[model samples]
Target chain A: MKGSLSDSTKRVMDIKNRKWLIAGGVVGLFLLASKLLQAVELTLPRVPLADGVDVAIEWATINLAPFFDGIKLVVIKLLVAITAFFDWVPWIVWVVAVGGAAFRWLGIRTAVFFLAGLLTIVSVGLWDHAMSTIALVSTSMVLILVTGIPIGIMASRNDRFESALRPVLDAMQTMPSFVYLIPVIFLLGSGKVPAVLATMIYATPPAIRLTNLALRQVSPEIKEAARSFGATPFQMLFKVELPLAVATIMAGVNQSLMMAISMVVIASLIGAGGLGNDVLFAMSRVRVGDGFEAGLAILVLAIVVDRSTQALGQRASKETRTE
Target chain B: MAQEGAPKLSVRGLWKVFGHESTGGIVPDEIANKSKEDMREDDGAVLALKDVSFDVNEGETFVVMGLSGSGKSTLVRTLVRLIEPSYGQIIVDGDDILQYSEKELVDFRRRKTSMVFQHFGLLPHRSVLENAAWGLEVQNIPKAKRLQIARETLDLVGLSGWEDYRPGALSGGMQQRVGLARAIAADADILLMDEPFSGLDPLIRRDMQGELIRLQEHLHKTLIFITHDLAEALKLGTHIAIMRDGVVIQIGTGEEILEAPADDYVAEFVQDVRRTTVVTVRTIMDQPDLKLRQSTTPAVAMREMGQAGVVSAFVCDEEDHYLGMVSFNGAAEAKQRGDATIADAITVDEYPTLPADTSVESALPVVLEHHNEGALAVTDEEGVLVGTLLPSSVVGAMAQEAQDATDHREASAASLEASHADDQEEADGDGDSEAVDPREGMEVS
Candidate 1:
């Protein structure tokens, strides 16, 4: 029985192999014919989409200057207000407040590290630049999270929306951060506005993508259980899906924060002054020691933000596991 | 047995083909008529459920039993519209729920039924109290009231002390208890359980089964349970529907299914169930061949025993209450001794009498130890002699079961051959007969 079965299978395979060979031969012949007819050359045509995009951006800049200026004014005021608040506070006050939060959410080790890091910034005489960097990043993060998390929620609920948003997000992540500046510089002009906008464009994808993934990964059985109890769509999202997704979303927020910090030196080119300006100044003057001091300040800020946000995510997950 | 009044839930002509592709989304006559295999082979559509139908009366534990892939899980999910039926009517309380609008369906799900899943799908982020109260919370109940009700429900399921613990912290059986509490806390009319204990260890599974039985006794909620384990079905189900290949082959009481399986498939499925546990003494008892009044003289009793061709006789009073067995030798000796009546000769001390409703498994040892004296007297609840049970009758009942099994196997083998011949004819004498031999081997063995 097995022998006959194998024989029939072999015959079927032979027929399939012959079919493949015939198709391959036909394709090979077509390619050979096309090569022989290469005298009739095919020329490519250009559509000039780049010129069209330039025209569109110029039109928007000319026509929507008032709306763009209003946005610019609001962002500048917000950034100035935050920077003023940081400037008004004594360094000890900032240290005590950030250190207290670190202690409560994380533990003594993180708190001590944050305090030591803050003292190092003060000792390096970069306290003002560090505070400006913190202000700019925090404001950009607020904008990123407010818009990105909701977009993530919407994308998570609908497949077509996610599919449409996927390529846009891919472009946002992969295109050079300088590419974002060309358009922002044309419309809003270079300043704190373009700097914050560029930072947002750079930092928002991780939040949206990770939030979508986290919501999708909140176990199907848990969703079904919620549905079986007749939870309305809104209740299911808020009570079940969001609560389960929060930890991963916190990780997304941490990524966004780190991305925002990575943009500080880049943002400095657009007159968003901070430690990044210090680094850029040092580089322009060929002062390696000054560059290292500025870089160390950014590093300290990144570590503090990364550790705090990760601890928060871990706490959320631990709550779900052993509440 | 309490099938009084209208049924609480009715399902008629339910069909759920997973990859259904008939035009207009209605089940096509051709696909519906074709066998499950033919439908899959021809159309690439799986027939997950095929014309399934059953009624669940109020407070009845209607168990759907099948092996894995037999669509028992699908049937339970379809009850709550978790998986929409490809076609059918699900009538609950005079309302065909298939016709319910979105709002009405939501209301129905909220108020009329609750489902327990095989995986004990509790929310991991929630405490046991909040998990149990989730059904109420979704309905927009106030927190205080819902928590109070959840507390009562957890207590009912014997989890009162652990209400504040997270579900991840509980053992599997206890987690399922929380699952049960969550379902019961909804207070719906019908409860659907889809193999809720199948994931537990054997010992915990048995414990949960007992817990469910106790809860059902107290609550009396209508239950539709699904399980692949036939033993679990028999133990918990008031009525069982045995399914095979997306079709319900039989629906009956446990004893009925055991005694008369509906088809070869059902018979094969039930072949390993220990029959003694399900078969009762009353089912196997026999009419007493001889009877004597206690007032009869020893000579007369002796003559009666002789005439009846028996070693002993059951002596009863005028009211037909069983007295004892009187052997022919004892009667003859009594007659020689000039005893006035067989009452003096009759002795009640030898054999233990069994109630008519005792299970055969419980009666086997009693009969084995005492059959030499005479047949054991089978009495009713009133102590009136109803029938007799002997060693031969026990053996005969079991032997008849074995004989019927062998006969079924032979019949099945014959039918298999006939079908194989038909297939060959349809294939136009194609020499592809090897595929049918393995099934033939299975049936014969």
Candidate 2:
């Protein structure tokens, strides 16, 4: 009796005593790393693989060019097509999508703000450009999720691979968005493709990092319960782990979408036309009214994507808890 | 009911080792070169389950009782191939299940067995009915038919009207019942429950246990239940297997385990059992002596029974049919009522009655429920009393058994220590032995 404690009591005490300090340390480290990287645009010099590797570099760049160019053309063509289709569809569809999401997540007041934001953008005559911006953001998100989730799953499955990739992910996330354009432009040249490539590099870290974090955070008890009931490893991942990690991964997607949207204006430097191009053109021409209108359009687009994804994430988490 | 056939499930020499280096080196030369202990120690492996074996008979409640980390969970998991054993074979319905392919394993799981998890792994996105139909759906059953079956199963588990609610809206016990209903709906021959009631409150746990027993009585499915609680094991198990450190220490009927534990660990388990309820009249019944003088008076009956050192007197009719039982206190209380007629004065229905065939476990709940001093054993269907049981006698028998076990354990420990001391003394008598010679003035306290 003196030494005995019920299993649940011990488990509760263990949870209460869990090391939240480690989480704090990780956040502090991230902030410090970000500040340091920002303070010094530190770049490591690349050594050529051979004595006369200039020819190889040119050959490699030439070889990789067609693929990047093809990707660029496809992305821009898809964006233009989506924008044209948006003009045909009633504006009410966009409003409903945005408003419905807001109502689900943050209720009526937020839903009103969502409608008001869209109305403000359209009233300022940037509706077409905003729709174009939405196309770009959605495209980038779909691409990132497709690539990032598998990579995250691989990283979670292998400790050495995950550890090796951790610092690379951190560097990509912390480095300036401008740095992505340098290599992307060299490979694909200035276009929507280079712009999307840069945005993908900048926005992808959260998806991978959060996927890994969420999978690791799943309780061992839940996993054991699944296994005890004859769930195969694949079944455990698809049925239990994936469902449980849906909220966190969706949050990652939301962050990626926001980052992608933020990169659109920066991406305009390479002829990635959208509301970003309008904002850049208006600013350079010193047209304050035009710049404000484009800026408002971007803001509206950001809010719509952010709210909808947030709503979806909340619904997923709520469903998980109910199950 | 015991069936005259092979067991439904049989596991033999099962071993599950995690993180073992030698697992990949299964070549004959390598295995022959390495000793078992050397391989085990050098590989730094954890033997989650070791040389464990058990057979679960058809239509019987088989309980695997062990504390956490005792390999009870591991053993159960291996039965379903959830955690595949490194060695040993599992035979289900007389076929080796270890040879099953991926598709075959899935088929086996869906058709032959279904499991209830402790945490109630209901699909959160699905409604209760949908969750219940999950297993049937996995088997490729059509949606409409599966839903109908799921609804019926939900009704069976007492969730008939709550089909639309998700698992979160329900309480913990209700969720577990949903888990049970889902397993039952699968219509598998074997039901494997891994500590299903462990998470519920005590009252709910008892209710669920009762529900399981009731369901089992009607359906007669083979059940493999795992629990750490000895009380639950005794209550639910037709046969209990007590495990320790990845090994089954004992496997027998509940009475065999409680009455005759294999070792100290199991003795400690049953030490705190409520002996008055667990012990039965059949276990301590004395033969009837008809030659004794018949005293119908309550006061006379009390004196005669007390003098005879019996806890109760079995009253019989002229045809030797059991009429009723009168305990010493019942007779004494009757005398205090100031009624001269013995039939009017004596308290006839003071104790519960059961047939001799009733299990100690089944009788326990009845006795405890009624708060009866004892139970009477009857022979005929018309409640003909055969013998009387005293609560005090059951307690005395349990106390005596416990004392004997304790004394035996102490004696064994003493003998072991004495043998060790003797060995040390003999070693000290050697001339080359390093000995601390006692000083003449030193007291040998």
Who wins the DockQ comparison? 1
Candidate 1: residue A316 Cα off by (Å): 1.5
Q: What stretches of model 1 exceed 4 Å from their correct place?
A: A1-46, A64-89, A100-109, B1-4, B21-26, B34-43, B286-357, B365-392, B398-445
**Candidate that scores best on TM-score:** 1
Model 2: lDDT equals 0.74
lDDT of 2 by residue, A1-323 (tens): 64466777888777766766677789999999998888676688877656455565567578877776678787777666766777677677877886886787688999899899988877777777777777777777777998899888888788998999999998988998776666666778787777778788889988998898888877676565445444666777887789888998899888888889999899888767889999899989999988988887888788877877788898889887743
Docking class of 2: incorrect
Q: What tens digits encode model 1's per-residue C-alpha lDDT throughout A159-250?
A: 99999999999998889988778889999888788999999999999999999999999889888878987887888889999999999999
Question: Residue A104 in candidate 1 has what lDDT?
Answer: 89
CAPRI grade of model 1 = acceptable
TM-score for each candidate, following the candidate numbering: 0.78, 0.72
* Clash-forming residue pairs, model 1: none
Fraction of native A-B contacts kept, per candidate:
0.66, 0.32
TM-score of chain A, every prediction, order shown = 0.83, 0.77
